[model samples]
Target: MSPELSFSGLSVLVARVAPHTVATVHALLRDGARVTVASSLDDLPTSLRDLAERGLVTLDPRADPTAHDVVLRGDPSTSPAPQPQPRVAPGSPDVGTVTLLGGGLGDPGLLTVAGIEAIRVADVIVHDRLAPLSALRHARDDVQVVDVGKIPRGDFTPQERINEILVEHALAGRNVLRLKGGDNFVFGRGGEEAEACTAHGIPVVVIPGLSSSIAAPALAGIPVTHRTLVQGFTVVSGHVPPGDPRSTLDWGAIARSRTTIVVLMGVATLGAIAETLVAEGLPATTPAAVVADAGLPSMRTARAALGEIDATARREGLGAPAVVVIGEVAALDVLR
Candidate 1:
């Protein structure tokens, strides 16, 4: 009683397994297009595998991308498939390069030209949750976007697993782009990735992005440094409270430094951070500010004296993925 599947002349090659990609493949299959996926059967969702068992999809890593009418990307925004590139068989002997790219804050507009170029040529993009999603829009239709975003204290792809995926894709002759938010070298664990690739003889490159530690504060109209306000600044991670064993920073030294202090990933422990600074000789009345969701449309900033900043940010409902700035300059609205 069902209508016959159509797509007599259309062929689709699926380069990755993602919610959008899988859904697209399902539609393509239902419409009778020949669908070939470049992933192992074990990697597919149950729904996709059911379709495969019904002779609707083919799993082939060596699938020739050009043979298909279109190559599929996971993002729905990339529909209509990009112009086909010179067909090359996946898993070819050609060694692919890996580019570690910084996605800047949350704004795609902040992505550097070099970073965009890298995305354009990448065969696979291994990205974090914070990376600018716009880069995915510019990727080739056949590009495989692997979401490895890490959520603070939530479900996330393990670093070891991410490292394995990069090496695996590159070894299969596919250019891999490792994209993360902020400058990759700035607590982004880029060094570990570079080391992983080079250990396997894969060539690696870096495209730096504007770090939120600096960009976020600036966008919120707070300068990290001012000649008359402070002589220098220190950037620290607030992932842990000051006295937690996991933290290696010396709060006393930071408090006594007499310079601007910029804290990243510190919103959860902002109160503790403020307390430690005050307990260590920093003035309780020092000006401070919290810039949340920088570069995005919903960005918000809350300012208060150092002792009250944590309470102020909470009262304002600011959350993680924010930057905290402490110094005399925090009170100055230079842009205003």
Candidate 2:
């Protein structure tokens, strides 16, 4: 039988062969592998050398890959059952407030239990075009769903107008959900809406979602940062061409760094951005990748050197809402 263990107690030493287990234990100690116990666990450490222990560590492949708090997140015997969902808050239907919810990446599975609860309780949802539409199903039949998504050079919803709607509905004594595709603070213009609410003395709340900047690349098997592979990474918007005077990014400095670079909303200006990087002394041979339609079953990816990424994207027929990753780590498609 496998050894029983508790990360909290740290009383149990779970490891492998005498030498390897010792080393693994040391590393776990250094890295503080100990997790705050939410439930209780036993018989683990898949890296163990003992075949009997490995058998105990095995789990259903379809289950969540990793546990957050093993005590609360893992198997039924070790983890507690999910709690019953709460009903919508009283007086929620008519509250002068605006709530910003990050709809997460395009996948409905990415939505958190808390986020789903908030959606069900909301009076109205003013959503972005890129946000997953499936989440709206959680709303009540009486709840109003509004589309305020902005498209490139197409049916644009002015920021001022969105703010107006937020204020108007909120003042009318309704709880409004300003649902955006990714984290509200990350290029989602959530700051403007919050400011509008504050100026009007309206209550505001933010429920963060996963930003596509990192999620898109991650879903495509790209890590924003890797040990020894990337010392750091930079994330920026590529919506505006580098040549444009209005562009505020310091392309020169960006090219000088070896840190990974992640560009969101820049597939259109990718050619110009690549040209600027090469001009600023970044090697034209730098690895780069484009991940399109991220979080969807139809997602696609194209890879090439920075010098050839634009051509690669063209060949792939990739479009906007894609993430462009450039750096030494871009080539690291570990999941592939």
Candidate 3:
């Protein structure tokens, strides 16, 4: 007989039908072992047949064990009893929490597992226009997916309204997932949203995602920094909001510095940016490249001299969701 088998907790034995001898030898008669056989009904051994008659085992006559299970039916004792998990009670402050998820560089594959899980469990999702739609496929069928995408000089839901929506959903006992493109903390205004949730005493979680600032240029075969080519890199937002006191950036110094410049959301200001750099003594001939829809299959990149960057990008018709890399490393693409 097989050695006394102790399954510690209630456990079921699931086996294929092809191995008849192995199933029969252990058929509900091993040393103090509660064995169950799953094989063809006609192939069951006498011992197994007797066990079935005595209720020690059950024969699933309707099942084709050759194709799936053959002999044993569901184990009465071994079947685990459904146990409820403890969760926040209704009306609890954290009962319906909000999660701020970073969708990562426009590539659904780049999303972290935690971000995917949050989407799957979310009662509602407020996503930016640039976030990959493929990432939302895992969500429940009835999930409420909202588009809060922002466009320049275009219709958009105000940030305050978006914040209110998040809070309203949580207060109504619904989980909310606020999904944004790229790293939430990296110019995505994720910090501001978190502050809003905290101010309302709503529980919140944040997931980091890949940033386009570095990924975009790298995908275009341009390294942001190299031991000999460029020592360091700096990421700056090209967007300047109206009436903002801290709108000014030292473009002259940035242009003259040795560090490579990676600008996000700068497509609209390319001409002025190029002009400023040239005026600041950076050579007009300095190599520069712009990559749009980085990390996506439909990505487009263009290379040009500092003086002709604006025209080159325009001629190529590169749109938003692009990153601009400026430095000697940008020239390496010409060699290939």
Q: 1-336 in candidate 3: lDDT tens per residue?
A: 122444322223444332123222232232223444455445653334433443444454344444532234432123233232344444576557889998887667788999989988988888775665546656665666666777554546799999988877776677889988888889988888888877777788998888888877877888898888889998888875212366677887787788999889888888878888788888999999999878655478999998998899999888776899888988775325
Pairs in steric clash, model 1: 129-149
lDDT of 2: 0.71
Better structure of 2 and 3 per lDDT: 2
lDDT (Cα, tens digit) per residue for candidate 1, span 68-160: 887865546444532323433334457678899999976777889999999889988888867776446566666776778766776478889
TM per model?
Answer: 0.75, 0.72, 0.70
| Runs off by more than 4 Å, candidate 2 | 1-95
- Give the per-residue Cα lDDT of candidate 1 at 251: 94
Global lDDT of each candidate: 0.80, 0.71, 0.70
Worst ten in a row by lDDT for model 3: 18-27
**Residues 297-331, model 2: lDDT tens digits:** 54789999999999999998888668999998889
Best by lDDT: 1
Pairs clashing in candidate 3?
39-70, 39-71, 65-69, 65-70
- What's the ranking of the predictions by TM-score, best on top? 1, 2, 3
